[model samples]
Target: MDKKRIILNIVVVCLILFSLYILQNLLMPKYVSAIVEGSLIEEYYNEKADYNHDIIFIGDCEVYESFSPISLWKNYGITSYIRGSAQQLIWQSYYLLEETLKYETPEIVVFNVLAMQYNEPQKEAYNRLTLDGMRMSASKIRAVKASMMEDERLIDYIFPILRYHSRWNELTSEDFKYVFKKDKLFHNGYYMRVDVKPVTSIPRGRKLANYQFGDTAYLYLDKITKLCKDNGIELVLVKVPSIYPVWYDQWEQQIEDYASKNDLLYINFLELIDEVGIDYSKDTYDAGLHMNLTGAEKLSLYLGDVLTKTYDLTDKRTNKEYQEIWQEKIDFYEQMKAQQYYELEKYGYLKSFGAKAPED
Candidate 1:
């Protein structure tokens, strides 16, 4: 080929690659400014590799909102990270666990059973929350396939611009501002809410014709179990103590049976609300749906014992390096807590936690 033709082709290829990169960045949701749950999955990549976590939490909002890694470190000297997002389905959890194994392997993998309720892909928003932050790999490809709805297309996930090109009309200053950067909104993937929304009423679960979990949900749970066993990671299944959702006895039996059959440890926090010291009147932020920072700390304190005794996790807080790292996290945790309390006192609601300020 002629030199001029070769040079032109090279420029064209470079331009195409660069354009796609920018388009992908632009089309992607900027979770930094709002709905920070979407940012939780991607933020785990920023963790320093020097400190190997002893435990890893994976599931949906229940996992993220219920467990506090900072509290775990403070109370049990256990280093941990939570890879959670809103409505993260079982297949998505399996794929996320598959992707996480590529990095550091924790001694135990905690899978919140709330996600098991969803057998099939539930919503595109939830799928994006769990998948958008994942780095491209075979696991991500598999996860996209497993979690996509009937209307979803694989190519749109691969080339996000195709899916999000319509967002051009809704682009705001925050979109362009955080195109390449975002505010760190979570502490080790725990989304904190310090304000209190006391449980006023408990909702009863509607009777299900089939109390059994779907086959697809069981299939993914089996995959998650095998992945953990293969990686030499113990799987701990837990049902966080949320007051309302009304975790039925039938569902409990299924999980208990699965745990017994698999020989895995399963703890239903709902059964231990008194033991965990979770006072819904003071602990939860959104009625009985999710726990606030206080509830998370209480739950973490309870789990710390199980993790240390059952799993034999060594206390890393005594290490000088870990002490220094956790101190910073502690400082941030306190700062957020104080800020939330202050906002609650002043405004009667959390204006600074996950929501953007009105001035912005």
Candidate 2:
């Protein structure tokens, strides 16, 4: 009777653990529908085993929406991934870089500079979108500590169900379908938008008493440089040509100065817009804030040339193994592009293709 009771207790514990795992899986955001940026970070884990890319882009929405790895591969044979999110702050980027180094070390790390303007944590929602997907690691723990708003607790990140259990009422069919798995929504972390929203009015940067980046921002920037140097990875700083939230002359000068001082390469795409052949009227999807597929491809082509020539990155287009992988990516890219065009034609705007604003 004692042995039987002990066996029953062991079974009960296993069952309880399994049930909690299922519940945690179900409660977490699927990120299949409205807010898909949340899905980007986790997607990296899925690809980690399959390939070791040559380049890794670390930044915010600008990097994901602006750079097309598919295009880069096709046009220049460069393999890359973007670990990006909405409003990804400086410290968050630093932690993310640290976490990424645990997986594979790439030859180059391209960091977007817009995030430098924000020295502190932003919002809990944005933090979750970026950090929740990161696998449990020392880097993730540091990211959670650095990114959490005052109202958030670290325990909530450790046990996500504690934070998302309230989502029981919000669960949809997607929750059940994607409970254990999710569809890949990005091409090597590039969020594609084929629809075009022409630039009308660009927002001017607000007048600031001090245009200098905060000390905290500089601290992480220095950390990023040092970390890359230690790893023998080239750190290339870039300011994507997002016309809004204006990239000021002061900011440009500061980044330029820092790059010169550190002997690092800094490329501001805003200065190369015309040279890159980006047409503002069609290149941007949500006005000039982010690029559409066309813009990304164009930019990727230009950057691919730079990487190939400057860094001497090999052209792997002829490699059979890489060809096999990229062929699937190419097919998916074309299919997505065609689908977006179809949706645009049918509804006069993209329906499920991450439209900035739904058409009336």
Q: Best lDDT goes to which candidate?
A: 2
Clashes of each: 0, 0
Task: For each candidate in the order shown, give its overall lDDT on alpha carbons.
Answer: 0.88, 0.91
Total colliding residue pairs, candidate 1: 0
Q: What ranges in model 1 sit over 4 Å off?
A: 355-360
TM-score of 1: 0.95
lDDT of 1: 0.88
TM-score of each: 0.95, 0.97
Best by TM-score: 2
- Model 1: worst 10 consecutive residues (lDDT sum): 351-360
lDDT of 2: 0.91
